[model samples]
Target: MGDTEPRLDRGEALAATGVGCFLWVPATGQLILDPVGRDALDLLPGEYRGLAEDLRPKILRDDWTLLSGLSAALRGGLKDAYSAYFRVALHDGRSRWTHVRGNVVRDGSDGVTRVVGVVRDATLDLSPSSLRPPADEDSDHLHTLGEAAIALARAMSVREVGAVLGDELCLRRLGVKAMSLAVLEQGRLRLVRSVLSLDDAEPPQKSRLADSWPLNDVVRSARPLFFTSVPDFLDRYPRLAPHQHGFHATAAAFLPLVEQGQPLGAMGMFYENTNSFSLADHTLMTAWSRAVARALHRVTMLDRSREIAAGLQNAMLPRRIPETPGGRITVRYRTARQGVRVGGDWYDAVTLPDGGVGVAIGDVQGHDTEAAALMGQLRVAMTAYAAEGHPCEWVLAKASAFLAELGADRFATCQYLRIALATGAVHAANAGHPLPLLRRTDGTVDRLELAGGPPLGLPADWDLTPYSPTSARLDPGETLLLYSDGLVERPGEDIDRGLARLSAAFSAGPADLEELADHLLDTLTPGPHAEDDAALLMLRRDAA
Candidate 1:
């Protein structure tokens, strides 16, 4: 009772000062409201006993979804502060925009007992020109954070989580032009991911924590340090100034990445132009670090998980193209960088018992471990079916049924090719996959159009409607290109543009099968990680 008196008095003090004070008790799952708290939420004083009972009705209907999540975040069990903003429906047929800022209070066992926070009017702050920016930006930020959480939750490895961080936090969205992420692995600092302009300067010969000073110091002190200007940084760490040559960063900040007070890593963000960070900017960066640290810790453990997954996938994927009399069978596979997933893309080439070469390229739906596993199973299934001397159409039809029975939930697109090594005859079937290209002896490229069938795993039942394979003739010195959609498909773009790019690449590509494979792969992969995994398999008939 004595403790309750001071809390009530503090609430009165908050109301007297034009701010509202709120106390959320997890035991009852209720918010105790003071006079200003009621006014801030557009409620009558003493009209509500607890938040859960009276709050939902008062909240604007369209904003209920935001409110529900915000309630969790505001009471969000985090070691850091939680904040949210939303509009409340008023009695006078009006709405009030309010911002709630608070921290969760937990008992000795780390169980949240209560949440204490402040509330204030913040409608004007929602404008972009306002000091606080708009709630839309806040909403986007929250949405990205939610996505990061989801990515980490289902991540196959730490690298997948790292990919999420790079996608979310890279670039200057948060005034970070460059970022370096590193963690202590077995008493050695292992660089997780670094996006910086180091120019020709080599990496530090040693990778021990003691080798990097300010970074190591922050990890030890458990605090963030910032340098507002390049000269300021150079002046403080004179011994480290010489290494700055060609590494011209104007401003820098370092944060000790931690999880529940345990040191996990150290992260640094840099700016190219001279600048100073505002207090608000510092606060936001700190919050981002806390979130990133949790994700990165898991990435550190994913080394073996990724290795095993990669080994399994690599084993399932073809190692080399089989020798064929028609010409040479060349293939290339590139997984997306940053480890989004091992990928569901697979390519295989095998010599048939009938003196024909069977080449298959497929992309299983999804970008996770399950997708990779399913991709392996389906690839093996296709190889086995094709080996049994089945027609192209039969292989796909049987595969569709096989995956359905194998409990495959994701869909996949595949292309199968049977090339008669002696006659240069091509029989191809596309299972809702991309078209194959035929590069002529005259340097002209055309699509080998085929009747498309359903992808693997669909209808929750089965859709192996009998479909016929297509036929095309591969003349001497002519090439047939089989590729996965990742080579041509991108978001917000037409597939034709990618096809045209492929055509242009083939026209200008080397006549040699091996060089052609590398040339095409290098031309399309614009970033370190292709937007998705890309597979290229090219075959040409021998003129001799």
Candidate 2:
């Protein structure tokens, strides 16, 4: 009887403050709510002691959907505490905004056993703004946060993530006046983006991590720092007094971007009208920071992966083309713009045993690491066969057999040719490769028609037709071009038309082989979003 009197007094005290407590046990599906909580949820005194499911009909359907995930977040052990703003339907046929802030009690295995929290009526706190409707302002604010998260998830680079955060529309949606993001690199903070309203003045692009700036302090401590006013910020960090004009905000919040227990960087948000952050605002900002951190980590990993792929691809290509005394030889290799930046397009200029220059250009079946590996092996085999004094046709045949023997379930298109340095004589063979362009001394370009066989790696019985050889002569001041299909393939376009365009460009190109190679790339290459690898090899016999 003595304990009951103290409990009653405590409940009365909580009711007077308009804050009510709730205890929920997930295992037994039991819920207990105090008088204030029951009144806010529109539940009768007797109805408050029932199961949690019995109160579902009192919540707005969309709000229930939004708040229901809190349980999963606790059960999965992903979050220890959460704050949610949702709508509840009252018996008077009207909706009231309710705010709940709770902490989970986890058992030994980290499963949520119980939840203890406070509930309050939040309808009066939903302020009207130009960006949202008055009736569902809180819901619209949450929608804006969801949109930002979706945009961040698709961001491919750190700069892209900053762009999403700094977009003016996104800022307006979230009622923020300005935003900034910085990344940590080698003990320094490199500012990625900043959208301040100050004219002709902004913070430095880079700062030492040990500096006394709010961003640096937040990163070092892995905590959030909020300033309610300019004076408050200056009082805490007096060293930044000189740069106060650059911020120009009444309030600001700096959050650390930490992933996997490592501090990656920090994000800063400035507000004009806000004098202080409410509990709801603080919770939302913290959650948003976590989403931004995850996105930054993901993009950084992708950047590293692309770098590694590009390095491997460059290492496999020829470091230098053999100096051909007969004529000038120029080559260029470009990675795809849209994907992994690695592919199987390769070019080789090998000095043959008979003092002739042997050149081969080929593209493997795919644009992945396995294709690149296969291309390396095939190039080595072809170069070796040419050095052993094999004919152009025989070299292609041996390459095909080598690819088939690997059982890689892939194929490649190749063009191999041997040219006599002194005589300008050419013997060429093709395997499902594009036709080479021959430019006459008069600057007229025409495709050299040649018999072709299937691409390499075909079954022995499938390639009964031999790879036939074609003979051609290179005259003085004339060029012969070999290129990958990427140079002529376009989406929603005909390859023949692209080939015709290339022929025109080649005919009008400069006499210098090096300059001509550049001309072809500058004129014939696709836009920045080209999705296939391209390789080019050009040889021009010296004028007699």
Candidate 3:
């Protein structure tokens, strides 16, 4: 539309109709309204000359949703023109019906970026015999609520929940200027997340619940608090007068998050120019706080549960890797990242009486407590058998038989290493386990091709063959790597591919055994969210 087109027709056809003109720029969120439009919205002449978001507190949540999505519909090519009927909160605490109609402005590239609209008082148009808003006008708010719920539900920790709530895109969609969340912990408030700030001084992360702050007051009284302007805030809390100069917000809302009559925490929202908050604003904010409280509680419990599971799993692994005087030993055990259940992967290293080191890495059949229990027992048996100076093959056989005798109806894959540090000799035994890799001093890598027996705990009739030891020599400055399948397993891909990747990583890894250990785990493991647990052991024969 031309600049003079709407003005000319508007002046001629609607001069006496009590209508007003507005031009909205989607890019900057600027909404310019003439004198009549200001009156129709019940706003003073100088009250709102900034962004459209500054009027959110005066509009109901559902109505705000309609107003915000109006330009979006035109930009998406869904419509060339739009019309909406919504209620605006009047200064006297009454809702007045308002009507707005707009047409999108497209540039030379046919891209819509601006909207030209006219607004008028629509209270009389909402009569029983008059036009009504579309039935789907309220659906937008419900959709917004549903999306937030889904994101909160998927959060695995309190930090993650905070991230979801503080997301910039989410805040933009809701027209929120700044947001802060704090939870009550043992009579104190602990800040969880803070997004966007209009204050020069940051709020303390932890504060006593009895502190003289709006958020603290809401938590104590279990009610919402609203400040219509900066002066309102200063008047209500005179003790904070000295800090008023640092606060740039024009309006603020602090809502208590209570569930089942129990107070959880509080949420604070700050706005630039919102003068008043309507009842609809109160209702919507209360509902949102309830959702946040629930999500926070759930994730807190999950994080604690995971910590407990991890503690138990750690208790079952070796407390220390006995010193290898003639070599270096580095080991790492990582639990599964997806769930609270403990996994069965474990590693053990013990200094032999004859100055050698007994190292073993294994994984049991399942990922539950039962599997973990069986792993502890099997690990002890293998350590005892190897410490007794038994051969590598004998240790595997005894451990396998011990697992079967437990009658747990489970199996385990294990690789045992008896290293003579002085001679750099490694005798490895395999029981249906991935072969150990030897990183030669020359930077080449090779697998110890040992014959594998059936996994431990199989019936005698089902056992294919006895475990066999593979003898390999590790030269000075060379390292031996033993790890569970999780270190080299990717979903829906061949094991060979993962193994190949591991080989390339190990060969090009750092020279220091300790750094090499970290390099292999960082390069080979999928991520912190790996589905399976992994235990890794690296032993390097130091040069004489």
* Clash count per candidate: 2, 0, 0
Q: Candidate 1 clashing pairs? A: 158-299, 337-529
Two-way TM-score contest, 1 vs 3, winner = 3
- The TM-score obtained by model 1 is 0.54
- Residue 505 Cα positional deviation in candidate 3, in Å, after optimal superposition: 3.7
What digit string (tens of lDDT, one per residue) describes model 2 on residues 171-281? 656677667899998899988866433332435678888877778889988888988978778888876677554456778999999999878999998887568787667
* Residue-by-residue lDDT tens digits, candidate 3, 288-363: 7778888888877777888988998999998888888889889987777666878899889887878899899999
Regions of model 3 farther than 4 Å from truth: 1-137, 195-203, 234-248, 260-262, 441-444, 522-528
In candidate 2, which residue pairs clash?
none
Query: Which of the two candidates, 1 or 2, achieves a greater lDDT against the reference?
Result: 2
Instruction: Please give the lDDT score at residue 351 for candidate 1.
Output: 78
Model 1 deviation from the true structure expressed as Cα RMSD, one decimal place: 19.8
What local lDDT does model 3 show for residue 234? 79
TM-score of model 3 vs. true structure: 0.69
- Candidate 2 lDDT: 0.78
List pairs with backbone clashes in candidate 3: none
Please give the CA lDDT of all the candidate structures.
0.69, 0.78, 0.74
Query: Stretches of candidate 1 above 4 Å error?
Result: 1-182, 190-206, 220-255, 267-315, 336-343, 365-371, 407-412, 451-465, 510-512, 522-525, 528-532
Q: For residue 284, what is the lDDT in candidate 2? A: 69
User: Which is the leading candidate under lDDT?
Assistant: 2
Candidate 2 lowest-lDDT run of ten: 127-136
